[model samples]
Target: MKKLYFVHLLNDYSGSPRVLNQTITALRQQGNDCTLFVGSSGHGVLDELDVATHTFTYKRFDNRWLTLLAYVWSQVALFFALVWRVRPEAVVLVNTMLPFGAALAARLRGAKVVYHVHETSIRPAALKSFLRRVIACCASKVIYVSKYLQVQEGIAGVPAVTVYNGLSEAFQRQAMATAYQPVRKGRFNVLMLASLKAYKGVNEFVALAAALAEDPLLKFTLVLNASQREVDEYFASRSVPCNLEIYPASSNVASFYGDASLVLNLSHVDGWIETFGLTILEAMSFGIPTIVPPVGGPIELVCDGVEGYQIDALNHELLVRTVVRLSKDSQLCQALSERARAKASEFSTANFQKKIVMVFDEL
Candidate 1:
């Protein structure tokens, strides 16, 4: 059995943590010893994992200076701890580019370091450059979540592989039980599940809701990956339409998918490109059609006219037209749903587990 060490910066109900949760669980089932190093500030999806967890205190702040200081300090602490405790036989798998200290520690102790890259749109151009340099200098192998990410952030000499994200069996079962059904008439719900960030197209979603408010049957739901207090504070100065319902982070998204006629991902390509869209796959598992950004990993999940249309979030007219077209024509919606369900079955957890385990075994 292999001894594996996993490190991630945040433990929020976001994409990276959820992916890490799946990786750790799958690896442990293969009889490998797993250890996790993560932040203790957020109580999220990673909390339920059955493995040895070592947490460090770290919190994010609005001020860039304070956030940078906290991040640097966490890495310093992690470096010392790992240097003292890590065995030479262990392989350290850093989840994102943020936890470079793990790579450094592993290299110092003669352990191998693998980078599972998921994002390319890191803020502050200088930091992004520095992180890539760290990966080039320290990582022995690189695993990218999507083909697009591999091309965007790949280093020239590093060995790289692409592994698409997969949906959990529980998620598939829940979707099948709750959402696989005939389309309802008279009420159409358009859903967008994302974090409460401006670049996530929160304003665009609200605008779309307002534009369609005259139609009594049309409604919009925005689920943010944040606490209730954060949700309230974010919309304090903004105007929310009557047809739009904004909610905080939720663990149970099957209910929303069940009620949804269509789902969307409106992240801006320039500000924050989506590395891999797990929510799009989740919606597809429910046979729910989606509209996602035209660029990045989301394009891989959704073909322009096959499963769903690819449109830029900044194009307000196109967004409205697509939503209206889907709303008015049930035949088109059903066709897309059928194709979407078929497409979703191609990304299975069993396949993902087998392939990812093979990578670990080879390492």
Candidate 2:
């Protein structure tokens, strides 16, 4: 069996780390030796995985110059450490910038390097273009999470593949259970679970809520992972129409999905149509219909009017009208819920792991 080393700078419970954890667990279950190289925040998720993990004392710096220098030093040190110790056949660099220092180091040691692109790099226009060209040319393989991202980068005629993010089997089971519950008495509950960032369209969701406030049938819950200060500032500036509650990030996310009638996502600028809309998928798994803007990852998951309807734009009037129509149509809601669950099953862990193992075998 080939030994694979995965590297990441942080170990937070975000999309990238979650995907890494799923990949490592899946790889180990198939009898491959996998090692995860992580920074200080390593102990939480990685400790539970079947694979081995190595933690380094790489401090995260906020100062621009110091951060760049420290990251370079850490990569160089880590590369040599891996070569002298684990000596893996291949290295998978999760998310890093510049010359993709980890990949370059692995190449020097005659080990194949794979670069997993999770987000668009931040650099001056000329430098960013140059970096993309170099990465496209030198890396042994490139894995993109979404087709929308691939097209945006214009990565043509290269050793590239699209592997979507997958949910765990447990999450799938939870979704199924959520879908089977009988409807309870209450106003229609709409949920928007996203970081309260500008680009994520939290403001648009609020606007939509305001437009529908006079309607006695609608209510909203805005779940955000932001500092209390930031959350207060956001609420102070905006006026919402319906009964609104701002919740801090909580572990009981599935419970929230279980209680909601619909999930809404309206991102303005997404990297790759969202390789996968995890929130929407989870909501669907629970048998709740979703509403999303007509762009990016949601379009791929939600079959407009079948699984859920897509808003033409973020206009408050349009959003209000759509919500009113769905709230009034019980048959449409049930049909959409059924279709959403079916769509979610296609990305189940079984299918995801099967495809991921195939990729490893080809390598």
Candidate 3:
């Protein structure tokens, strides 16, 4: 069995971290030795895993100097510690930016470095791009979550692979069993599940809600896990339509899928036109149609008039018209939901693990 070490700078339970946890579990089940390194202050989703854990003094921040300094120090300590303890054969780094330090350390200790790309979008800063290009050149292998992301980033050559995100069987079963309930008392239920970040277009959702306020039949709800403080502050600053409700992010995401008539994701800039479309997949698994902007990730997942509609832009008029049409056509909704569920099955966890193991064996 080959020894593999996975390093994650932060341990928050985001999509990337969840995927990391799933990958580690899959690797361990195949009899490979796996270890996880995480930040001392952050909480990891992999606590249940039986792998060895190493803590480092690191933090996630936009401040480049502080972040880099912490990473350098932590990696230095980790390298010496691992040298005398468990000398891994290979190392997988989670994020592109933070992996440079770890990769350098691993190389010094004679270990192969695999860089995983989870950041779908890049900042417009020139310095950031330069740093990323330097790291990309040093990686032995690059893994992208979506092909669209690779193309968008202009990452050519160097043996790159696309591995989409996977959903667990439990999540799939919950989605398949979920039944959509009609709006009571002429109220239409629409949900936006995303973090309260600027790119996620929560403000656009708010604008859409405001535009739909004239219609007594429409009600909106936002299920946000990250940026709770930002969302709360935004809500406190403005007068949202009475029909709109902002729900905090919940672990019981299945219920959120079950309760909504439609799911919405309107990102301003996405790497892949909806690379894996996890939320859209979840909504589809629950047999609900979704609406997304005609941009990255969503375009790839939503089939225009089939599974879902893509807005021309974040225009209120376009979203209002689309939602009205879908809400009125029950047959259309049913057809789309059926097709979406079928599509979601392609990204099951079993299939994901099988593909990953196959790739590892080939390597």
Clashes of each: 0, 3, 6
Model 1 weakest lDDT span, ten residues long: 177-186
Q: What is the TM-score of each candidate against the true structure?
A: 0.97, 0.83, 0.86
How many clashes would you count in candidate 2? Answer: 3
Candidate with top lDDT is: 1
lDDT of 3 at 304: 86
Give stretches of model 2 more than 4 Å off. Answer: 39-50, 55-88, 93-99, 121-131, 180-185, 227-242, 269-273
Candidate 2 lDDT by residue in tens digits, 229-315: 668877786676547777865545788887887788876644223445668878888888888767765677887888887874456
Give the range where candidate 2 is weakest over 10 consecutive residues by summed lDDT. Answer: 268-277
Q: What lDDT does the true structure give each of the candidates?
A: 0.88, 0.70, 0.70
Poorest 10 consecutive residues of model 3 by lDDT?
Answer: 268-277
Q: Give the distance in Å from residue 104's predicted Cα in candidate 3 to where it truly belongs.
A: 2.1
Which should have the higher lDDT, number 1 or number 3? Answer: 1
Which residue segments of model 3 deviate by more than 4 Å?
41-44, 47-50, 60-88, 95-97, 181-186, 227-230, 270-275
Root-mean-square deviation of Cα positions for candidate 3 versus the true structure, in angstroms: 3.1
Which tens-of-lDDT digit does each residue in 81-191 have in candidate 3?
Answer: 555543446655545455455666665676666667766454446545764674556566667776776676545555677777788777888887776544535666888
lDDT of 3: 0.70
lDDT tens digits by residue: candidate 1, 1-363:
998999998888888888888888899999999999997678888988988999876788878889988998888888887888888889999999988788899999999899988887777888889989989988889989999999988899999999888877788778767644334556888999998888999989999999999988788999999999999988999888999998888878778898888999999988989988999998998899999999999988999989999999999999999998888888888899999998999888887888789788888
